[model samples]
Target chain A: MQRYFVNADPSAEITLPSEAAHHLLKVMRAGIGTKVELVLADHCVYLATVSVTEPAAKLKIIQKLLSNSELPVSVTLACGIPKTKEKPELIVQKSTELGADKIVFFEAARSISHWQGSKQKRKIERLQKIAESAAEQSHRNKIPLVEYCKSLDALISDYPATKRVVAWEESAKQGETSALAHQFNGLQAGDSMLAVFGPEGGLTETEITKMNNAGIEAVGLGPRILRTETAPLYFMAAISYAMELS
Target chain B: MQRYFVNADPSAEITLPSEAAHHLLKVMRAGIGTKVELVLADHCVYLATVSVTEPAAKLKIIQKLLSNSELPVSVTLACGIPKTKEKPELIVQKSTELGADKIVFFEAARSISHWQGSKQKRKIERLQKIAESAAEQSHRNKIPLVEYCKSLDALISDYPATKRVVAWEESAKQGETSALAHQFNGLQAGDSMLAVFGPEGGLTETEITKMNNAGIEAVGLGPRILRTETAPLYFMAAISYAMELS
Candidate 1:
């Protein structure tokens, strides 16, 4: 069954948003009695059926299903805005599939592209849509939010978690292999983690110093030099393997 | 410093391959005395400097550097051919970065796209180039080979490993979480692993049954559903975490 994120309370009849209705009715060609999964506002998956489609596409809730496809510890990936437009899109899509709770693109000292004014809002909206689709495809109960942080300072101040770490390339260069595992070992269920990554040129020394002072320890993904976009996905997967699978 | 994979013995002077020469001379604008890291035929990183740029670029090896950026256990990803062209490219590139030793695409029962005759050779050549570039960017000692197997039987017979597993969605649905870790725990350093994945429609029941009979264990990545391309990368990352990082 196809899944859609519906923003409403559990009721007898539920109307899907316009975009989802268009996808169900026109794109998927779903008709009356077609079954689907709707993730309502409570972040729960509910079995639903297409009941009415004349005025608007409405689904009748059948029953709530016991589905939990989220990470034990919430992960918030704060990335330094990469140079190309496709990097953020790739990060959001892949990280969401890997079970990220939130994705934030922050302006780093070495960042080339800056998300400003209405461009920031438009980009966030587009990325949020990508996250939603990815979440549905991955059968995730929660759709990860996409946001933009104006600077490293704003990111440090805003997203506080039980644990904070920066994916620093120098850490790997210095052979600091155990910091990431150490961080993972300390995480408990329901604890949130904030992982920061740099852009193309990578994070500046001053930025690293500031983050270090703010209690964000620097860790490495592995020995290989990962590109700006690949590091976060690696971190997400490693965390999932450590916490969920292992 | 720029890195290039040169298929030559560790000699005092080494002539760069045509493609690497063009990239070093034209793309990087490297001149005499420019430092570079070359992974010679012995699977070792050598510090080299540009010695000649006339006719063909040449480099003089200074000294061998101690570097090992590979997973402790060798990993071979055997994926069922994906539908779109981009998914294979993405899988090849990302898996190479994540330390895959080899990547093979086999025709699955549900595969929509088929690679035949010269088309197969051409597609493999293009994907091999992608793997090479990704390997260099990730500073890998060995460039992972990109291959196409005609069928699943061919994949099973051609590449024998110490451990063989398949990423099956049914295993995840059934909550088989410990199987992957169990496989990883059984692996020793220098041991090779073959991980198989299905395509868009996924592997047929017959294919799964055949693998099971062959003693290839079915392992679940996690509760979330990964796309045909995402599952192999997830397996690669998980193995690296289990064997290399943790």
Candidate 2:
């Protein structure tokens, strides 16, 4: 069954937006009485059937399904904006599947690509679409938000969490293995965690120092040196394994 | 400093292979005394310096670095061949970075792309190069081998491990969360683990039943529905977290 995120009252008819309407009617070739899952304004999954498909795509709700796929603790991934276009897209897509609540890209000292002005808005919009699609394909209850942070300092200040950690290769080099597990173990239900990651060249020493000063602990993903795009995905998977599977 | 996998005696002068020589001498513009880490036939990392770059790139071992980046448990990821060209490449690159010992792609019942005859050899060779490069970039002690299997039966029967588990979405739906953790915890040092994952459309019930009859246990990665490419990377990271970090 297809899943769409729509904001509408469950008591009323749900009309998909233009893009989603095109997708359902044209791309998927869904006709009237075609059953699909809709995530309503309350972010709950409901079984719905296509009722009107000519002028606009509309569906009628059957009943609320007792389904919740969100992680128990919300996870926010703050990554340094990578140089290539593909890295951010990969990060948003994979992290959303791994149960990230929000994905933020910040301009670090070593960042080569800067999304500024209108470009920033366009980039975030595109990545947000990718997140929504991935969330639906992964059967997630909610779509992860994609945002942009101007700098590392702003990221640290704007996103306050119950626990915060910066992934540092130096920490792994120093064999500090317990910090990430320690942080995961300390979390309670509904607690939020903000994990910061570096870009291609990785976060500079000054950036690490600044994060260290802000009371954010430096933790290692593991011993192997993961690339900029791979680290946050690793963190997201580790978190899921810790909180969900284990 | 760069890292390369070389097969030579640590007590003698080491000659770089043709590709590594070109990468070090031309691409990286390495000069005399340019230090690099080399993994010898013994699979141990040694600090080496460029002693001669005339006929062939040659280096002298300075000392052993006492570095070990391999996982305590060797992981073999056997995946159903995906349709897109990029999925296999992504799986090879990212899984190597996360410390996979070997990666196998087998033709599942629902596999869209089939690598038959000579195409299979060429594809494996290309993917092998990607694994080697990713291994070097991630500072891994060993490059994960890329292999192709004719069928799922060959994958299950040939590559024997101390433990075997298939990633099944139905297992997750049935609330089988403890199986994966139980398998991970049961693994001891130097034990090998074989994890099987389906392709895009997923494995058929017959395939799952065959594996079940072969005594391979079904395990869930997590609650979310991960794509074929994303599941192996998740397993790699989760294993690293369970065995290496925590």
Candidate 3:
């Protein structure tokens, strides 16, 4: 069954947006009396039956399905803006599927690409759309939000979590085995975590110092050097391992 | 420093091949006295100095670098062949970076795309290249091999390991907890493990039953549904967490 996210409270009937209507009506060829899973404002999955169609799509609510696929911990991924256009998009799409709560792209010291003016909004909108689709495909309870931060400092200041950590390559080089797991083990349910990652050239000393000052512990993913896009996914998976698997 | 894999035994002096020579000279712009790390046939990391510049790239042994970046327990990822060309390539590349010992792509019941006569060779070659590049970039001690298995039976019969597990969606749907960690706890060093994953549409009940008959345990990754590419990565990170971090 196809799924769509609608920003409305759990009610009797709901209508999908134009894009989702097209996808359900044309792409999926859903007709009258078609059953689909719909997520409303309460972030709950409900079984809905198609009532009306054509230009606009309307659905009548059946019984709500008791589904819970959200991560126990709210994970916010703060990544340094990578050089390529595709890296952030890929990161957002994959992380959304992997159960990221939020994703923030911050401008780092060594970041080559900068989003300014209308480019920032357009890029974030495209990434947000990708996240929405990925969330539906993964059957996530909530769609991960995609946003941009002005700088590393602004990111730290804006999103303050219960636990904050940075994925430091130097930690892996120094053979710090238990830092990441230790950080993850300290997290509890409903406790938010903010994990920072570097770009292509990696985070500089000054950036690390600032984050350290803000009480963010530097942690290692593993011994191998993951690329800018790969590190966040690794972190996300490791988080899932700690909270969900273990 | 750049890293290269050389298929030579431990010796005093070694000359790089023509392809490596061109990559060092033209691509990396290595001078006569440039230092680079090489993983020889012994699978040991050794630092070497460029000795000769003419004809071919030659290097003299300086000293061995104490770099053991591999996972403690070997991980073999048996993935169902994905639909797109980019997916397998991405899987190989990312899994190599995450410390996979080997990657096997098997033809699954849900697989929509098939690797035909010459396309199989081309696809394997491309994925192999991706694995090699990812290995070098991640500073891995050994390059993970990319292989193909004709069927699930071939996969089960050929790849024998100490522990065999499958990432089953139904297990996750049943809210099973810590199946991967439970398997990881029983593993020892030098004990290889094989983890199976499904394609986009996912594994059928009959295929799961076949694996079960062959002593393959079905394990859930997490609560959320993971994409075909993301499942293996979650397995890799979970293994790393169990062996290296915890």
TM-score, each model? 0.99, 0.99, 0.98
For model 2 chain A, the run of ten residues with the poorest summed lDDT? A6-15
The runs of at least 3 residues in candidate 3 whose Cα sits more than 4 Å from the true structure, single-residue gaps closed, are none
Could you give the CAPRI-style class of model 1?
A: medium
lDDT of 1 by residue, A102-163 (tens): 99999999998999999999999999999999998999999999999998989989999999
Q: Say which prediction, candidate 2 or candidate 3, comes out ahead on DockQ.
A: 2
Give the TM-score of chain B in candidate 3.
0.97
Give the chain B TM-score for each candidate.
0.98, 0.98, 0.97
Name the candidate that leads on DockQ. Answer: 2
Docking class of 2: high
Tens-digit lDDT track for model 2 on A1-246?
788899788998789989888988889998999999988889899999999987888898898998888899999999999999999999999999999999999999989999999999999999999999999899998999999999887998899999999999999999899999999999988999999999988888999999999988999988999999999999999999999889
RMSD of each: 0.9, 0.9, 1.0
Query: Of the pair 1 and 2, which is ahead by DockQ?
Result: 2
Point out the higher-scoring one by DockQ: 1 or 3. Answer: 3
